[model samples]
Target: VTYSRSPASPPDGPAHWRPWRFRMSNDVWGTPVVAGDLLYVTSFEVHALDVATGRRQFKTKDVAWTMAVDGGLIHGSDGPTVYALDAAGGHERWRVQADAWVYSLKARRGTVVTGTRGGGVQGWEASNGEKLWEITGAQTDFETPESGPVIHGDTVYIWKDARLRALEARTGMERWSYPVGDAASCGGVPVRVCAAPDGHVYVVAGTRVLAVDIDAGMVRWHFEAPAVFLSAPAFAPGPAVTGGGVYLADYLGTVYALDATTGKDRWRIATESRQSIEPVLVTGGNVHVGSGSAVYTLDAVTGTPMWRFAAGGEVMGSPVVADGRVHFGSADHVLYTLDAAGGQLRWKLATGGEITGSPVARGGVVYACSKDRCVYALDAVKGTATGRAR
Candidate 1:
């Protein structure tokens, strides 16, 4: 669920769910949310499914373009407003009008925050939608496309066109603004930043990956690739997800691992790619990634190729590693599950349409959403279909 995950109620579970599988409506974007016993999937509607049984618990109208759960509440955005809903009942707790179209929602530490298309960034009370504070006194470009704010701890990092700014989580005070660009100017290309465990940031800017120190408020080091600089919003690099240190790929199909604290180059390797190195998911001693038609698993500690599996179609979504298996969708309208340790094919299931979003799991159940206008919940082991959308 790379679109976003609830920062508070973190989802943790097995490698794959194969015994009991199920299906629901799908979409071109969005990820499923697994909180406790309920799995929330968003397509044309927001549905809450029983994690163990794959039963539809509740459904609501289009609520969250992006969603997160915190402090026992579900926070999401509908067009230009933010709504707090009961996670169990799918009922609205409160709604607040934003300054512009609210496209992203993040809730953590008892607060709900959002970023708008107009570059307006603000937060509110998670319980009743009381306005908190907004970050001010910086460049507010109406033309620059905006994105969501992600919280690591007490800081919220937001990226616009070229600048990545961090603000105090509670007071909305500006902490630092780093201008990320190449040799010439800054503020044009779409950028993404991921917080590292060492309180540093791995930023993806156009054709380079940079390591920025949160405390010092500057870049520790940056690795540039021999690729064309991408501007605006067409084929931007994926979000840099870090594990032991930093794992990111550029548009040129080069994946680099840099030391999280020292910014030392651990290893750099080329991938079998035609377009972009979308992103990497690191967990359970393995790194799951895709480029073009093949998915590769590399040793996170030594950067060794464990195995490579070429799918029947183009691997579109990022691979989610759970329950000792790698579950991902392909452009051929099929979801493939591979043995995480050996790269053997366990099973492949056909969906109604192209699988757009990544698969997510919790409690031995995996959830996938596709353009087939449905979401599927499959058993981690048997891959059986347990539920279907009505």
Candidate 2:
């Protein structure tokens, strides 16, 4: 029952199958978000498609980056305007313009929030995109904002000029701000943090990695390492409650696991070469990640090298572990599938262009988009490609 735009050749399937096609523009700059039978994507235009029919349900051409969606609305930003659209019909709701480019968008309750270049932060109505309030004026100048804003209940968190600000999600009022380091000294927007399942915010700043308590907004622990900076803290769900250890990768091609509670080093692995993708920890003590042209599996607990698999090109997006497989896209214009535990090659499907967006797996389908401007939904367990040409 899977539909696709690529001429379906039943390489290994039933006889009475029909090949399908979903028409799209020649470029998909953002990722695809699948909901039910409808798949949503943004490029120069926003589109909603019937995944099983390869038919366009709705299309909106005004906005560019459809960043995040939740609470039944498609939230996005183009330049400085953050807008929301009716999730079902692609109908325009309302739009709000920020002082700088809004690159990150999120939604919670009735509000939509976005982070902007030059340290601008804003909150809006998720239903109408009305500007509820905003906060600006950080100490140092910021560059293009790319880091996401994380919301923990009513608290919205973002880094502006090297300071991570916790704001009242409703009023855009600052609750507390923590300075990671000198913003100007480390370039702009240096710290990237994620909310651990244990409720602590883990961030990387200069040579120090920090864990901050969510409610009190105080630094609970900090770890120092001489690792090259690039990757952010990654946490896995486990029984360790004092602080769930965080995993990170550095530009120097090393991965480290740090105990969240004591800021102590657990283990580190040097990936023989450089790695740009974030390390992914999967179920059953498996960690899957990629570097340059190589993918690897390591013991999630012991950091012991398990196996390594090489791809055709560089890996940019983080590897997605799902349904017993590790999925990732490469600059070589191919989407690779690997056994999550053994790092063995499953399959690699070639694309017409480079893939930067993360692969999304839902149901039994693996969905991915490439700069060549196409979105594909492949059979996750079968490697049967089903998708459209731009």
Best by lDDT: 2
- lDDT of each candidate versus the true structure: 0.67, 0.70
Each candidate's TM vs. the true structure? 0.82, 0.87
Cα RMSD of all models vs. native, in order, equals 6.9, 4.0
lDDT of 1: 0.67
Residue-wise C-alpha lDDT for candidate 1, range 1-390, written one tens digit per residue: 111122222234332222333455345356677887787777656778676555678877765667787777888787777888899898889987888876667888877777666567787878889988975422343222233466767888775445678888878887998876432343244566677666577776666667778876887877665553221111112232433667666554556666665656678677755443345776775666787778888877677889999987888667887778888889889888888999998878898778876788666556787787766766555455433344
172-239 per-residue lDDT for model 2 (tens digits): 78888887667654433356667776878887775678899877789998887775456567887664
- Per-residue lDDT value at 239 in model 2: 43
Runs of candidate 2 exceeding 4 Å displacement = 1-23, 97-100, 139-145, 184-189, 240-244, 272-279, 385-390
Compute the lDDT for candidate 2: 0.70
